[model samples]
Target: MIFIEHILERPNKKPILIDLRHNESETQPIVIFCHGYKGYKDWGAWNLMADAIANAGFCVIKFNFSHNGGTMENPIDFPDLEAFGNNNYTKELEDLHGVVDWVQNEFKHDNHIDVSQISTIGHSRGGGIVLLHASEDSRIKRVITLASVCNFGKRSSTIGDLERWQKDGVKYVRNGRTNQDMPHYFQFYEDFKANEERLHIESAVKRLTIPTLIIHGNKDTSISMDEALNLYEWKPDSKLVIIENADHVFNTKQPWESDDLSPELKTVCEEITHFLKQSEV
Candidate 1:
């Protein structure tokens, strides 16, 4: 069964959560999936993937970032593109951490999930956030990142862009989905600058002693295969799997395809399942 609800966070803002429960006789491990920038829980084949993982004797929670363009009214798509534009790296990291806190405190007793066996799976930019969190928080026993970026500093186009953003008070980027311009204020850059040291993935990955999984598509155009290699290089113990024909997003779409996941996504899910199970040993 699936339990969906709006959970309140630190600032009193509620983020939607999709909890897939397992009815098995024995207690199961917990896996929290974090969606990346421009992504949500209900996107594409995520729900089906969640069910598959849950059926494999695990409880999974998938949620949206409080500021991830999804409002309480309509938690899908960019209805509030302004929020999307104003989103920053620090805020997303905090939101992920907040979810972790909620899982440990609020959902620990009711569900038969093993609080001590908490693991995380992050997609794209969300992977970066998970890496930082897992390194700092000893609670996370396992970590996984799908097509994650190695660095966030070069995401912006130009050098003096930070100054321009501050002077103008708002900077805009084109959203292909809505065909509209989205505004990102100066605060986004300022947040990164404030936490540059904390945001370093290389340092965090090096410190990670827990089982780690890194999956990437060799054909992914958004984040190069080299980035995945870089992640594996930092943590030699990490398991790295690269799908030959898969592109970014794992060949899924907004509207979604048929019941079958693209060959790439299927492999990705299987790899995750195998790694998580092996981590138990």
Candidate 2:
């Protein structure tokens, strides 16, 4: 498989780290995978997932959102908390747009990717980000969301917490895995409020005419199954698959030790490959 890591940079925006994986095929459908909040391109078994999709005969492009906290030097941990704090929905949308634009116009030639046939797969919060992008961007032909959240307005903080955030101008969420206090500036909420209509997941999903696959674990504790049901209800034509006994990460963990995917994640990847292949026809 051909593996290349490049940085997608712009004048003012922070540089986004991107990874492209595929065989020597001259032309193949493209799959752009988006990692969830606090997630990076190399998180857990995602590289393995990308390789699996590539081996299945597609070019898999996985990228880190510019403001995802990991700097160019270290793309895995929370080394740049300021950037993480400044990240908002708008920035993430722009980052996704940037990746798509690069894939369609710039990277296709070098990577032998089919710019015309593009699919996006997002996990958790990235799921919602892809949904909004797919609704607005006609270039995305298919979308697969794994353990995605249905609503962005839902507060991770309480009223008292919001009050404190308002007074302090920022709030922090502790990362249990890294033991870092990730910051969420008040502007993050402000930006979401400013673009509430554009960021509505229900409206976006309703507007999406392309094939969409919603996959969620039945035992997911982070995002409830109702969100998946809500997505299915919003897009009646979209397919929903609930894996029984799987967790939010689909049984995959950080510092993944095994060479092969966990049974649940392997199943998820199989479903994804099947869906993309079927969509091609």
The models' CA-based lDDT, in order, is: 0.82, 0.92
Q: Write the per-residue lDDT of candidate 2 for residues 6-78, one digit (tens) a residue.
A: 8988997799999998888667888999999999989999988899999999999999999999999999898
TM-score of every candidate:
0.93, 0.97
Which candidate leads in TM-score?
A: 2
Worst 10 residues of 1 by lDDT: 14-23
* Residue 103 in model 1: lDDT: 78
Candidate 1 structure quality by residue, lDDT tens digits, 104-126: 78767864778778899999998
Q: Model 1, stretches more than 4 Å misplaced?
A: 12-18
Pairs that clash in candidate 1: none
Top lDDT prediction, candidate number:
2
Candidate 1, TM-score vs. the true structure?
0.93
Prediction 2 global C-alpha lDDT? 0.92
- For model 2 the TM-score comes to 0.97
- List pairs with backbone clashes in candidate 2: none
**With candidate 1 superimposed using the best TM-score fit, by how many Å does residue 129's alpha carbon deviate from the native?**
0.5
Runs in model 2 deviating more than 4 A are: 108-111
